[model samples]
Target chain A: MYPKKFENLIECLRKLPGVGLKSAERYAFDMLEYSEEDINDFIQSLEDLKTSIHHCERCGNLSEDNLCEICKDNRRNKNIICVVQHPKDVIAMEKTNEYHGVYHVLNGVISTSKGIMPDDINLMTLLDRINDETQEIIIATNPTVEGETTALYISKLLENREVAVTRLAHGLPMGGHLDYADELTIIKAMEGRIKIK
Target chain B: MYPKKFENLIECLRKLPGVGLKSAERYAFDMLEYSEEDINDFIQSLEDLKTSIHHCERCGNLSEDNLCEICKDNRRNKNIICVVQHPKDVIAMEKTNEYHGVYHVLNGVISTSKGIMPDDINLMTLLDRINDETQEIIIATNPTVEGETTALYISKLLENREVAVTRLAHGLPMGGHLDYADELTIIKAMEGRIKIK
Candidate 1:
């Protein structure tokens, strides 16, 4: 058995997503054995993360201030907006280094089972941002049922206006075998095929 | 890519065992999302672990002060000392609720491959603790080759002393099948079998 103070450490570690009792115990021992300077650095970093990071007012991405770096960059195409489900999805798309447009994080996709709707997300703000100058609205949502439903709802809402809507092309993974491909994926790949030049 | 301030949080999370790039990224995000009050509690608990936990002066086990509860208990037998390689091992043996004597932690085991010798361990303090009143010394090292070598070396060093030296019994685990056993495990089990009365 550990001391009462160690119990507190275990309890705090258990709050982590995947950490359980044994993992919490191992983490407590690791922390107990670490040098004072290293422990202080860990704790200080956690505090800094809590205090310094905030959401970007324009794009809903995480940043240090109201405006994220992408929103503040004048060189970027403000007329093209890439709609994503979460801030992490924006980062994942950014890693590809292909898209030169701005981003709009919806924070979550529409889920009827969870009682989430288009109004519950940042859809109104996105509509307000749309103008005659806006050329494209890329629906970069995930390839899930909820993502497809959300994309359809957004597309229908923008149909009354003059903005062009597009979705990411779906296909098998780069290294995946066609023999193991699922029916839905093959159907999507066929439906999203491009025309020859 | 992340900001310089966020880099520290990522680095700290990466240092943890089994936490790779993706896991570190998730942990950093979780920390960034944690509330200020939760961050304060985490920092306070870390500081408490550093300032409050101390090694037991007699056995080197973790304690709130110089003496652990087991070492300070007047009813426990002081003549027999169980020597372990680390404080976690002490907790494991204690969980069995079988041993009721004091303990001596070597802090680490002797490993020539790692440039560690007998002198590098806390063996000298253990020798100093032995007296005429001492009866037995249990060597509860792990079953690794390094652990066996350390146990053998300690047994040889104490051969001339009056105290009786012993080791934990080893064999196949309960309900284990022989066909699934490894060669080293079979050898250990064969070497440790007892004769019937």
Candidate 2:
């Protein structure tokens, strides 16, 4: 138990995912004991993050300006777009440093149960961006049911177009054990084996 | 891996005690995905806490003004004071509602290894508050080596004074297991058995 103000802080901290009552209390106490300069810095950082950051108009990724750095970078290939479900996925792909193509963040996958549809996404904007100059559109969505459905829908929509469509090669990960690999991964790896595809 | 700004957030979060790299990343993502309204609310709440809260000058407990609510309450006996190591202990005692006296927060206990001594604590102010009218002083320090040393030093200092010194009873707690009890607790329980001291 704590004073009303401390309790309010604890409640706010508990609202964070995975933080329980004990952890909330610890965080509240830590905040309370933080040096004035540290507290100000933390508060200022939060305020800056909230007020300064926004979704990139082109790719839906987090950015300080209307266009993200990736979308604006001239070195990246604008002709090849790697489509992903969320902004976090863009970061994950960027860590590999293998893809020089720009990205198109879907924001979310098409979930029929959740009432999300093709129209709800930025599909039209994506289609409008594609022209004779566009070489390829890569579907880098997760290997989940919704991701597959969304990828299929996107592929079907682009089927009549001249640009090529491709999905990430499904297979066992670099360090994965064959015994522990899921049935789908093994099957997909088998079906999509590169002779070289 | 994330954008430079998100990576900055994670680095700042990692500065907090007990939060490691993984937890910092989790907190960063949580902040990113948090609703705009919720993020604003959290930031505003942090601002409110920093602007509204003040430490009690008298007892070192957190308060809205110069004195904590407990110290301002006239019904509490000023003639008897319970001394503790931290403000959290004051909250714990307040929950019991059994203590009717005021409090004296030492802020910390004596630790020769840490270069802390009696003068390092708020002991001078505590002694100044003690008058001929004051009847008792309760040492509610935790049952640690440092706490015991601090209590002994305070008791020796008060030996010539008219005040009666007391300590919190040490024994098997309400839901405690005797088999799991440490040697010091069992010894203290035996030594502190009720006597006409």
Q: What is the DockQ of candidate 2?
A: 0.34
How do the candidates score on chain B by TM-score?
0.83, 0.81
Model 2 regions more than 4 Å off:
A1-5, A110-125, A143-160, A170-197, B1-8, B33-40, B112-123, B171-197
Q: DockQ for every model, please.
A: 0.44, 0.34
lDDT string, candidate 1, A1-197, tens digits: 66667778888877777878767777777777688888989888877777776777788777777788888889899999988877666666666556688988887789998999898886767897788999888876766778878888888888887887877566745544332445566446535633211
Q: What residue pairs clash in candidate 1, if any at all?
A: none
Report the C-alpha lDDT of model 2 over A1-197, residue by residue, as the tens digit: 34566677778778766888768776877787678777677776677677766778988777878999998899999999878877766766665556788989887779898999988876667897788999888876676777778888888989888888887666846543333445566456534533111
Query: Between which residue pairs do clashes occur in model 2?
Result: none
- The clash count of every prediction, one per candidate, is 0, 0
TM-score of 1: 0.82
> Could you say which candidate leads in DockQ?
1
lDDT for residue A119 in candidate 2, whole number 0-100: 85
